[model samples]
Target: MRRPLRILQATALALCLLTTAAPASASAASSPAPSPPSAAEAGPVLAVPADLAAEEVSFRGGGGLAMRGTVLSPAKAPVEGGPGRPGIVLVHGSGAGVSRTKLREEAVAFARQGLSVLIYDKRSEGYSLFRRSYPQLADDALGAVAALRSRPGVDPAGVGIWGFSEGGWVAPIAASRSADIAFVVLVGANGMPPLRQQTWAVAAGLRKAGVSGSLVERAEPAMYRLIADGGLFPEPYHDPGPTLAAVRQPVLGVWGVHDLLTPPAENPPLVARALEKGGNRRYTFHFFPGADHAAHLSPDGGVTRLPELAPGYADLVGSWVRDVTAGRTPVAGTSGPAPVQDSATVPMGPAARWESAPVQLAALVLFAVAFAAYPLVALVRRLRGRSRRPVTRAARLLAATGAAAVLGLFCYLFYVLTTGAKLAAPGPVAAGRPLIWLALQVLAVTCVAATVLTASAWYRSRGSADPARPGERGERVRLGLLLAGGAVFVPWALYWGLLLP
Candidate 1:
């Protein structure tokens, strides 16, 4: 009973927060760009170098949507009939922006290394917060690849895909489907399912902000599962294992040591193992120090992402692309400083069908009706000039505090999601708990104690009640409803970690 109510509250909270983070836009096509952990977060824009030349172009994406982009190449163009330059198609991680310049830093960096780079606006036709098709996105990426291949200076045989974050997943799918995608590059990629990665990300973000206790250890995991089960988290259960295993292209994986979103230490080994499982031994892994998830400069671990790419990051990509395209595949090995991960990732499979989205929504509706009935009935009796039968003070406290705690928990979690846990400012911390969480826990205990007192009062008065007292039957009815609300409250509180120490 309590589990349903708890999941109900969590599902509601997560749905609202997720919608706010990745709101559905009128445009159907969207790019999965660097958001936080998986993708769909927006990134900062920087100027492309003036020395490089850019060409505006468009191509057909998945479902025949017109995808637009730019091709950046060296100043002295390669002659149309001459040997073409190696090329790369940059895949946006996840976001709504469709400008071709979204990946100016990468395009310019690789172009500077004599590789033509295509950066494009990901389609908006079939993408948003509530829905997306990765295979479709992969098709869109392949479209960009074809466009790059056709460009006068780009070598069709050497064309490849570079995925960052969300793009990491899409790139492999594209590579696996097409032998034309000669190579693959991934930055901040994850080996786990999207749901698991997201669950780990929020917890990691909270822990990085010095948070602990139930919010991180308990509520966060439960909340994410409820969210995914509700179908609000698109592609939450997407397994990248088979996709990576199918990729036969020469692969180069990079991670920033300070990356907070993806588990750097965990993912590389999983990726390497998966690729090796496919009998591909031409993969290389490297780690960059003092960088964030996007390989951007991060002075304070990965809490804040600065606009500038980490030193040697662009150069590494440029040089690696040059070598790999030229058949100089590096020996399969992992290099650079070991990646950092403070905690192991938690598993986040879908919730049981009993705890599915509709059931959770229905449970929430029931809780709302039960809790709201107490005060509404009292107010109506007062308005009708009906003298109310005396009820114990404990009953009133239970009603007030129970409602307040639920509402507060909902709002606080919303704040954490919308503004980010770090920006939500959980206030002072002591004993591994934040002040706000402590207050809610106190309220939860108060509600529980009041329920016991209220029940005791009702039990004592039951036999004393006359069968014909004017409002006795009504008073008993109201008390029963309040008690029922309390029954639901216990499990609800426990589920949200409010009842936990």
Candidate 2:
């Protein structure tokens, strides 16, 4: 009996082990497989044509940002007689974001013409993260140059940076820090101090919109004060001249004759002169006649209807960029054909020229005056009338003032919206009109709401109703006023300013 029992126990233990082990083995086999590698990790380097393939490369920069750019050899395939290609890095202008499409287009154009090109996004723009500081961007650009030098296709000794607008400013600073950068191309750059640049940008914008010479003259001091004090007049003033003069690099400056943002009178030549004064001989300047900023491309590039000017302007830039990269001198003169007779002849009178300045000034002054005077006037009337009336009068006065403010705000917003629409035609005056109008509308609505709510509460407390049960009817009326005011302000402002612009 004991032997039989032992046999059965041993069999049962073996059976239990098999049951548990079988499920475990099956689970191991049935589990999901691991995922494939991501695109960034795989690092698939794109191939160029057989002749151009020698220049193609992928490199990693110091900021932990991987940059992918192309190298273009001077000859088709392997050639015996041709010189090696020079290298150029194309930097983009400021816009909604760093333009990868623009950069690629520029690189390909230069590459086809026998040059190696590296164009990458600024940190926080394009494929990179957003909101990176200027210093970080400069560092990334520096890193790109270092990476290019290590690559097989690039001529480490011959590297340059071609920058536009903000890029122009950044290139000099970066070049100063790195010896690798051999030259710089600055499109629509200015030599004046930054404060002066700011003032000039504003003044030029005004002049383009048809502002009077006298007003511009009068406004200059205030504009200077605004920049000097860092907004409106304050105490210490900051100057930006010395910083600009510190840049030591070969520069090529380009500007548009009708560039309202940085007027020709205030920009290109001025920048060239600054460099010249610094005893820098390696400089070239070019200005496009009758061309608005970024509008003139290849002399025959037609007026583009795109909202942003980057696309229409990219080709001309690519052409010049090709020359710079190929170690050829850039021709400094007008490009593309003149505009059509009708388009070229559109008259820009005085009113159209300086429209931005006066409109902006008027709106600012109105807001300031309204905010300051209304409260003081209301207080004075309340105190003077207190001798003959009950204390409740103060509360009523406050409510009345609040109501008036709301009314004024409604009027201001209405004017901004309607006038903004009227100003939106494709002319000099309307260029910055939309931004100005929107700011004014925001100020008006904010001021009215703040004053009305604060003042009405003060007035209601002064009334002779029960301390705990002050008039619900009056409170509701005031609440209704606030709501009604917003309802009137929003739609009207949008319809006038946005739709019109």
Candidate 3:
């Protein structure tokens, strides 16, 4: 009976496995093979000028990935016109998936301006049926240039590429490989070494969070290491400096003043420095005030979210393109002035000095409180023995101290937040002097509160005697010491470990 049952169970398991595997195998086997275009399908249908249409094109890119793109052209060249019109390519940033909508809009915008535009889905984005790698993306861009050149109304000699964010890097890398690219526009592009950029980003975030200077200083190394390792601890991603230096094209780098993710302060100077070193005077930079990373989606200062197009970005970009394509020098005032220094200048204001002092004082006070609070509570418990009191004075002291400590922490956080905001705001008065005063106040309040809370918690616990041994204090002194130690060290650890980079 047992043998038969075991055999039956084995048979059921085999059937289940076959059922699950059959569909996947059949699906793979039955998938259709791709077909190629016949000779008759080689050229686009030539409609009249009023009936111009867009067409989809597919080709193989680098690493054997099938790439797809859309090409828009004048249905019929004007009777008196030459063989082709100027061609342009639009490259997308890393966002909620690259789409043809942006490309279509760009193509129509350029087409309206009398230039043919070829906009394609990036590898693995939109309708393209392949995963993308950096090398593959570069190849796709090159392929786009080639596809546009082959179109009937596109002039191979007048080709250019416009890229945003990560696309900025892609455009130049692609342009370097193709001689047909006439020019390039890079929006929110960086020229800094990747490590420096990452460090700056971390520091800016910590500053915004109201972390103090001493803590920031101590934390800087750890933060840099985190960035250097590319969010991992062992290895880094791409190195920006070497990669950027390789491209030798005329570039217009655009950035926003209030961009927190990739601050202009970190990248603009790097670009300017690189240009000076290379003796390449062909680049230009434009910085917009009060704009974030996704500035293109928020042109009118209304919405401040990502992925939305900033107001006036398209117009600004369009103008830049026209000037570059027409061989006109960008007016110096339109693109912001060149960076003055290669590295960020550290400000030595009153805020910096005060921050250092308060942090040192806080650390010392915390240490004292941690060592003294317990002993003081124990002495009081011994003196008040056998009182039969409902609440012991020692326990009351501990509760009061805890409350005060909590209050002090809240006040300190508030002051830091307010001060940081003021410092980062546009029209900066002297924030350093005021910040110093604020830091001192925070230190004083926190010290007093920590002392009071340690005492209060100790007092309150002594009052809660055990039911069997009603008069005895239950090791309240030891617990108070532990709490005090935590209060002293946790904040310092957070500050020194994460904020300074």
List per-prediction Cα lDDT, in the order shown.
0.79, 0.45, 0.51
Per-prediction tally of clashes = 17, 20, 27
lDDT of 2 by residue, 1-501 (tens): 334334433432342231211111122223443343343553443444554543334444434444544444444542444444456776666543353555554455556655666765443322211112344456666766775666554567767776665566656667767778866766655454334444454444344445433223333333343222322211112221343455565566666555544445545545655555666656655555545544343232222212333333444445555455556764434333332211111111122222333433333344334334434544665787732222334334333443444334334332322222112121233334434334443454554455455456545655644546544454445434433443343443342232122
Measured by lDDT, the strongest candidate is 1
Q: What is the lDDT, from 0 to 100, of the residue 182 in candidate 3?
A: 74
Looking at candidate 1, the ten consecutive residues that score lowest on lDDT are: 33-42
**TM-score of candidate 2 to 2 decimals:** 0.51
User: C-alpha displacement of 358 in model 1, angstroms?
Assistant: 3.6
How many angstroms is residue 227 displaced in model 1 relative to the true structure, after the best TM-score fit?
1.3
Segments of candidate 3 deviating more than 4 angstroms: 1-53, 72-83, 95-97, 102-108, 124-133, 198-224, 227-237, 242-244, 288-501
The better candidate by lDDT, 2 or 3, is 3
Query: How does candidate 3 fare on TM-score?
Result: 0.52
